[model samples]
Target: MSERHVTFDMIVQAVGAVAGITHHEIMVAGRAGADERVHLRYACWWLASKMTSLGPSAVGRLSGGRDHTMVIHGQRRAEELRATSESFRLSTDALLGTLQALERAGLLRFAVTIDPLATARRVLSAPEREAVRVSTYEIVAMSRLIVEQADGDPSEPSTEETAHAA
Candidate 1:
């Protein structure tokens, strides 16, 4: 009804566009919880969608009135859990693939960075995507990164650690 309300609705739509969960579902899931800032709220919607259309009650309780952080933590935990569990990883890859499709459909942008227009072709190329799938390094890396970002903690990679991984 109000301009502020419209802006909030758009955020929900954008998140729904990316997660395919819809604004109505997010509203219902949220229950009576704190807003928890913008990015965190988006994370909440995504986790709620992932957990069997589960309402926002679980997430709300965990967030400590910080639904946004709760969302980030929940997704982070989901990703961490996904790493050692084959079925979980498969489920995630499937969900992410579907979400990426929606993003590619103009609902949102994946923003695959590139060196040049010529090099950009490789970003979405099947061979390139397949090349990156050398086991399950992504979920682990991403969850850690998200946790670090949300917690304001830097992910300091020691030179030895980097060299070892390399």
Candidate 2:
């Protein structure tokens, strides 16, 4: 049988199925609070990190364009929850066991090369897309600020912006 490699997309879908949530729910970055979906997101992060060779940054990008630090924090939170919550531990263990069994059966392999922006465009809702757009703008603004500082000319706009404005 051809080995079906696991991707972050698959992991998110699996976690959503296991948690009785929709993939959209899993992918959405909702407001931080006592939402149960947050735990599910953390679980997805933990599972993707453990099951794949992707680093925190890669996982973060694939998951939701989140920062690597947030991924790391989610991983730590998953560990803490596993230690303290028996139900959470059991659920995670069951999911891990299922994936391991698939690996052994040659049904699935843990390898992926994902394009974060492409995945974001495919999976993100309008609001999420807007968030990514704003992030891109912020990065451009920071770059312009750095260039201005280096050139010692705060009044001058970037050449690219000037060209666009013309």
Candidate 3:
């Protein structure tokens, strides 16, 4: 068989795609000086964000290849770096955008399902209004929401919700 190719970038892409998340410039290698800790810490953030386990304990556990203190140190350093570094900020935005794009491209996570039944009142059309009355109220994915605008809030309404009301 021809050699099946596998690389860190490919692995990260696969992981990200399966998680309904996205990332870019997935480099796997040794780091130099400050970059070493920064990269590992960044990886921790990226992975935890994808897993949505950003709590202190969860992140500490996940990032613990070294001592938990090291993970904490990295996390603190990254937070500090973000405070004053414009270039880092731009790079972070770019990386996050790549992840989001990968998600939209169906590379990282499962498709988000939609919710059909809503608790909306006086906001939907006559047909939608009636539909909600009969539909049971529950959480919905609602991937595609197309409704006429009413006030600023889509879920709530007030006297001002309908300016057309006389």
Best by lDDT: 2
Q: In angstroms, give how far residue 48 of model 3 lies from its true place.
A: 2.8
Error of 3 at 158 (Å): 72
lDDT of 3 by residue, 65-130 (tens): 245555566556656666777765555555555655665555643322112334333335565344
* All candidates in order of TM-score, best leading: 2, 3, 1
What is the Å distance of residue 79 in model 2 from its true position? 0.3
lDDT, candidate 1, equals 0.43
Provide the lDDT at 137 for model 3. 21
Question: Could you give the C-alpha RMSD of every candidate to the true structure, in order shown?
Answer: 17.3, 14.1, 18.4
Stretches of candidate 2 off by over 4 Å are 1-4, 31-34, 116-166
lDDT of 2 by residue, 1-166 (tens): 1433666666776887887665555656657543688888888889877777778998876665789999999999999999999999999888877876776777863454445345445445565454444345334434533453353344467788789999
- Which scores greater on TM-score, model 1 or model 2? 2
What's the true lDDT of residue 10 in model 3?
33
Best by TM-score: 2
Worst 10 residues of 1 by lDDT: 1-10
Measured on C-alpha atoms, candidate 3 has an lDDT of 0.41
Candidate 1: misplaced stretches above 4 Å? 1-66, 107-166
